[model samples]
Target chain A: QCSLDSVVNKRIQEALKEYKPSIPTKTLSCVSITSSGRLSSCPAGMVVTGCACGYACGSWDVRGTTTCHCQCSVIDWTTARCCHLA
Target chain B: QCSLDSVVNKRIQEALKEYKPSIPTKTLSCVSITSSGRLSSCPAGMVVTGCACGYACGSWDVRGTTTCHCQCSVIDWTTARCCHLA
Candidate 1:
């Protein structure tokens, strides 16, 4: 049987290879708002991930902003809650 | 109700504000190995996030590197499998 190790190691190598060290804040030169208008992003290479809220609320109209209420009537509504990843 | 929408929106604002744009590769000044040694990180503001593997395997030594084998003997063995974040 093929050793599971090879598969595991392959993944490890992949993660390590994909890992991109972050840039320091002092040197970052540019920051811009995303087209969605909800979140901003770094154009260069210092894109930040894992930065998100517990949930998203409200609705977005044709304008770049959400049109729904910025508040939820109940607790933990998946669809009603806005989840943004950028 | 206090309004879940407000809570959701508050989180949204927090995420948008925390979003950090990346720096251009041309301007990136430095790159170095992390203290852990397995992953490299950017020293500047352009830190990459959401870059991780699905699992973690093996063991890690007090030393910056993991001591575990890069392989899993069984399928979907969470402990035997290695998942990395960073």
Candidate 2:
């Protein structure tokens, strides 16, 4: 008689070895922008700005040479506003 | 005299409006392959086979014309093995 348990175990192992997982073909990237131009990171909670911007409760202030006490929430920080020198 | 509060508030609003968030430039895609050929969704916890395959305690058996009792955890289901006709 064929051992059902052994047969199943063998099949399971074979299937596991012959399996191949997929990965995202395309990459997922995002950008961040400030009032001036572009920035590295943004304040916590606050999004990049514009795209889905908001103010974070705790985070470093955007770098720039402006006394403007404002925050931006952008979608892509790559092309987001950075700073202005007026 | 300029009110610090008003100045800050005005700047904040302007910055908020002109803000924009960043998104993943590249798409993150994955493929899934089965012992047979390809399949749709797989069991939970168990990834697709090969790439990062595994078995789930609860889930429908992959569709196919085979009695192979095995599970796969694939990354992308687009090209994951489906079933066999033996």
Top DockQ prediction, candidate number: 1
TM-score of 1: 0.16
Of the true interface contacts, the fraction found in model 1 is 0.08
lDDT string, candidate 2, A1-67, tens digits: 2464455455555544654433334322333444432244433322221111223211112222211
Interface RMSD, one decimal, each candidate: 27.0, 31.8
For residues A6-77, write the lDDT of model 1, one tens digit per residue: 554554565456555556544333232333323333334332222111134221111122221112233232
| Deviation in Å, model 1, residue B21 alpha carbon | 30
Stretches of model 1 off by over 4 angstroms after superposition: A1-26, A37-86, B1-25, B28-86
Per-residue alpha-carbon lDDT of model 2 for B18-50, expressed as tens digits? Answer: 545443443112223333322344433323321
lDDT of 1 by residue, B29-69 (tens): 22112222233233334333211111232222221232212
Which candidate tops lDDT? 2
